[model samples]
Target chain A: MSPVLVVLDLMGIFVFAISGALVAVRKELDVFGVLVLAGTTGLGGGFLRDVLIGATPPAALEDWRYLLVPVVAGLVTFWYHPTVGRLERQVGVLDAFGLALFCVVGALKSVEYGLGPLPAALMGMVSAIGGGMVRDLLAGRVPAVFRSELYATPALAGAAIAVLLDRLDQPYAVSALLGASVCLAWRLLAMWRHWQAPMPSGPASV
Target chain B: MSPVLVVLDLMGIFVFAISGALVAVRKELDVFGVLVLAGTTGLGGGFLRDVLIGATPPAALEDWRYLLVPVVAGLVTFWYHPTVGRLERQVGVLDAFGLALFCVVGALKSVEYGLGPLPAALMGMVSAIGGGMVRDLLAGRVPAVFRSELYATPALAGAAIAVLLDRLDQPYAVSALLGASVCLAWRLLAMWRHWQAPMPSGPASV
Candidate 1:
């Protein structure tokens, strides 16, 4: 991995961790709960992908820095939650970058592990959204991806693009860049436009 | 696996899946959601344990029977939810049986995959409770495991016993039976005795 990519990846994890910490603080969870939420929200998607693809001792678990980023983020939010909560929009934008990078990287990894293109793409989306799902579950809420604005579709599209390009022998950097751009642009646009996923039509059967 | 164990495993999945389906119906989720919840509730724990242990393309995914069981269970609950809901007590009992089988099977599998005893035992508990956690999450609730009476502890104890017995060179049948019995008995006793886990004292800081 290039230095730039590595930096972006870490930044993504950092922002995602902060989001988790903010949620924990809002819920009044203790220090341990806050740290756990931060770590899972930062790294849960990759852990899900790695475990599914038989990558034992997930990369996050093997690397100390991965563990450190979330803890620090959690503590920062725990102490300065008011300021952090006020900066939700900025944090959300950074989270979009994280989502984009994770989608492409996750898709590429699954493809390299011999999963079919569709499954790989699905895995990519999972990599991008799985952490938030875990965080929401732990916080006792429905996952935002299920009802939030156009989040998963963009992720799926980006992953599909990356997997397809990689399978066609495209350079990793090119595939990643194009895929990340698509996801990032779509996500930012959705946020700006206030796009929403369709909810169930009519009264649901009781 | 022996024929008997295979049957027990399937039964466990069936009961767990039914419980998930019931939750979905009560939540007024559509048929698709009901099926999804059933499958995840039945199989999520094993998936978690397998993925963590680097067992890719989880056993439930590879086997058609594994996929079929949950779908069938979901359909059954969807069509007869009124009757099934009334039989909640009976279902709870069956669920205890499922939990017992899952913990032992999960721990034994992890130990076979070269996990440390403690981690293997933890994985076992995960396998038993994980599906319900996923079910609760999808249904937009906190998981029962964190607050439920004498649930995870029994699962862990059962798993520890199985792992320890296996390490001591006991036959697989002997190890599994003792572990399952211990778990089943404890769980049934808890339900019968109205046991509750200790909750935090004092007012939570908001």
Candidate 2:
């Protein structure tokens, strides 16, 4: 992996871990439970991506850094959660950056595995969202991606752009940067503008 | 799969799906949600087991029987949940049986992947509990297996016994039967006696 990609991967893992820890604090889970949540959130996306792409053991399971980063994030959140939780918007921004980065990384990995563009793009979206989906399932809520938030759409767009650039014979690095930029820009814009997908109306029938 | 094993696999799948659908009904979930829960619960274990073992597309993803069994079980529960729920203890008994069968199946698959005995045993236990764990997470409850339940322990023991028998050149059919029987017996006994591992006491100073 490129140094840039590695850095981006680490950032994504760190932010996801923090997000999980924040949820753990909200739920008042024990330290072990909090650690499990944080570690799995950090690793879950990449794990699924690796499995789909035939990369056994995945980078997270192979490298101690992937595991250590999440543990540190979880502990930090546990100790200073009151202050950290106050900066929820900042955390969301960080998460958005991480999500964008993961989208690009996932697409790159898929292409590395020689998967088709469409499947690679879908893998990127899945990689960006899978861990969060697992986190939300554990937390007993509908996943954020499934809701009206601009989560999966941005990731999908990012991956699609990356795959398109690859098809156009752009360098991998260039495609990755473009993909990440698009996702980050779109997600940030969505958050700032409170953009949401419209749900079907006519509720309260039950 | 052997004919006997195939039949047992379907039996386990059916029962697990029934348990999942029953839980959904108890939660008063809509029909679609019930089916989703049932499908996820019935297939979740094998899905994870395959992914970990590098079996692409996962058995649950490729096999229509795996998909159809859960849907059928969900429909059945949806139509007669009041009656099924009344037989909660009976459901528990069936769940134990399913758990045991999955444990052996998971172990066998892992060994086929060339994993060591310990890892194979872990895979078996994970496979047995994985679906229910995901189901409970979605339902917003702590997974039953992670707690004091004897669920994982029996699966592990059974898997170990199977591996030992295999090493001793026992016939595949005999080993599988013995393994499944041991797990079933242990699990059923545990439930009957309300057996559980002791919980950790007091707050952690760390």
What DockQ results for candidate 2? 0.13
Tell me the native contact fraction for each prediction.
0.30, 0.14
For candidate 1, lDDT tens digit of each residue in B116-136? 999999999999999999888
Question: Which of the numbered candidates is closest to the native, going by highest DockQ?
Answer: 1
Runs in model 1 lying further than 4 Å from the true structure: B1-39, B52-54, B57-133, B142-206
iRMS per model in Å: 5.2, 6.7
lDDT by residue (A1-206, candidate 2, tens digit) is 76866777888898899888777667556554466568668878888888878887466644556767888988877777776677778989999988888888898789888999999999998888888887777766677777756888999999999988998999988998999899999999999998887777888676
What tens-digit string does per-residue lDDT give for candidate 2 at B66-120?
7899999999999998898888889889888898889888887888877766667
The TM-score obtained for chain B by all candidates, in the order given, is 0.98, 0.94
Weakest 10 consecutive residues, lDDT, candidate 2 chain A? A27-36
State the weakest 10-residue window (summed lDDT) of model 2 chain B: B197-206
Provide the TM-score of chain A alone for each candidate, in the order shown. 0.97, 0.95
